[model samples]
Target: MAKLYSKKKLAEAPKMLPKQETIDFILNYSKALKVVKTSNGTYENIAN
Candidate 1:
């Protein structure tokens, strides 16, 4: 129960968006949140 979005929780979501789409979304989203991108290229709390 973290106050902010947790990466573990996001991992359980359905992958409606493909890999390429996800990558693009993560990049933009991370910038907005001012969070560093993970090695996997996914932003924290980012759902694919």
Candidate 2:
């Protein structure tokens, strides 16, 4: 969910990284865009 990645008011949020398995889950389960992390720490959306 987008809420999972949203910033909280009081505490610092934990950093999230997307792996291949996670991308697969997103593709299967949700309507969210699939994204992969690059070596330089940027995200690239996976094409459907």
Candidate 3:
């Protein structure tokens, strides 16, 4: 079902953006992690 939102309601909605700390954590974690591609052409995460 399609629900329409009023302009005022949309404007009042809070900005749904990730916090700086969250982004930093994700970036640091990804940097420390390792990844590789398999024969099927798909990525795999091997953090250990």
Candidate 4:
């Protein structure tokens, strides 16, 4: 599936569309991605 979140699109989007679920999903996905990166050691979790 095409991503519901896109960095480029988000950068240009107006600041209104993110309802609670969208925000929650982004937060959860980011956390999970960080854990995956840490476990694989292929990418650094620079946000920390």
Positional deviation of residue 4's Cα in model 3 after best superposition, in angstroms: 9.4
TM-scores of all models? 0.31, 0.27, 0.44, 0.38
**C-alpha lDDT values of all predictions:** 0.66, 0.73, 0.73, 0.64
Backbone clashes under 3 angstroms, per model: 0, 0, 0, 0
lDDT tens per residue, model 1, 1-48: 575655456456676756997899778887666445777796545433
Candidate 1 regions off by >4 Å?
1-18, 35-48
Question: Global lDDT for candidate 4?
Answer: 0.64
After superposing candidate 4, which stretches have Cα over 4 Å from the reference? 1-15, 35-48
lDDT, model 1? 0.66
Question: Which tens-of-lDDT digit does each residue in 1-48 have in candidate 2?
Answer: 999789678987899889999898876755555666778886856455
The digit string of per-residue lDDT tens for model 4 on 1-48 reads 356555355356567777899999888877766433455576645354
After superposition, which runs of candidate 3 have C-alpha atoms over 4 Å from their true positions? 1-13, 36-48
Which parts of model 2 have CA positions greater than 4 angstroms off?
1-17, 31-48
What does each candidate score in C-alpha RMSD?
16.0, 14.9, 4.2, 13.2
Model 1, C-alpha of 34: deviation from truth (Å): 3.5
Error of 4 at 23 (Å): 0.1
lDDT of 3 by residue, 1-48 (tens): 234553345356678999999999888888877666788886756463
